[model samples]
Target: MRQYWINFKGNQEGPMSLEQLAQKGLDETAYVWHSGLADWVKITTVPELNDMLNNSAKAAQESPAELPEQEPEAVTEEVPELETEEVPELPQEEAIADEVPSLDNVIESPAPNYGGQQQYAMPVAPQQGPAPQEAPKCPPTNLVWSIIATVLCCSIPGIVGIVFAFLTKKYYREGNLEKAQRMSDYGAWSVIISIMLGIISMPLSCAMNIFKVAM
Candidate 1:
């Protein structure tokens, strides 16, 4: 007796006679190998195995009718099958009908108007970004006034004012509005402070000279 080997699901599980192989009830999809085979092929691909499957199928069909009575077989032969058209199963049709309700019972959403004078789409509001912070108004630079104060009033304070006047422009360009404004205020206030001091120091001396000349 010839022996065959079978592989199933990545496990090799046979080196048996055909009877032993048939006992395992393997499907034709199982791979079988025997001597002279190049590689294992599906049992269905082999002609011998194909006939074996067909024979088994015929055996299965005959098993139910294998009762020891010739009379039932004679009766079956004598009886003629009626030619009847098969109507569709009612339950399946009813199931489909239930799934999809009639249009009469369906609630519909309002349809869009496609007729004359199509209305324009509503304008969308522009996306607003963060509002820009307004730059603080820079005070007077006081550059010319600082120079005059340096000559007539106080040298140090007037020079300091001139320095800040120059800084104001630089700070403003660099987006430091706060620093620019402070520099501008410092420059203007320096000139005012110098004027006040000059008046306080010379006011009395000038008045005395004027009174003496008037006499």
Candidate 2:
């Protein structure tokens, strides 16, 4: 029997009988040569190595090197919480003010009432009780005019105008309409008198100054 030899790991690993080579288990793609063979051939081609090749292939299939499939990395998601906003309550007084009717709402009457008779043609005014007396309108104290009169005209009437102006506002606030009106008239008269005096005195004052300068 010719002894078989095989190369492994880049060197001659065996020079044994075929039976011994088979027992040792040849690689599936191992190269083998013998005294009769022309060149090295696959160990599997040899009938003797077939059992070893089958056993190796079965072992490899049973214990594969690939890692077990990983369950798709557990996907974890964080859901954010939403915040709630609160509305503030309005005060009773302000709420009541909003509910109150507007002043301009009471007095407006757009269309006149129509009647067939000429005598009834005049629109009857809405019935209402005698209206409360309106507060009196105060006249200006003529303070500006009073100051002008005092500076450029006679001082006596200007001072009186300013005094009457002050009295006009005071009497009106006190509900003394007659007195307030009287004060208003007097104030105007005082300012007029002061202006007339100032005009008349202006020429006299200039003339007197000129006469003194000549002297």
Best by TM-score: 2
Off by over 4 Å in 1: 1-138, 205-215
In candidate 1, the residue pairs with backbone N, CA or C atoms under 3 Å apart (3 or more residues apart, or in different chains) clash, namely none
Write the residue-wise lDDT of candidate 2 on 32-132 in tens digits: 54432223334554443444455455655665543122111111110110111111112212322354223122223222222223222111121121111
- Alpha carbon lDDT at 44, candidate 1: 59
TM-score of 2: 0.37
Looking at candidate 2, the ten consecutive residues that score lowest on lDDT are 73-82
Instruction: Give each model's whole-structure lDDT.
Output: 0.53, 0.50
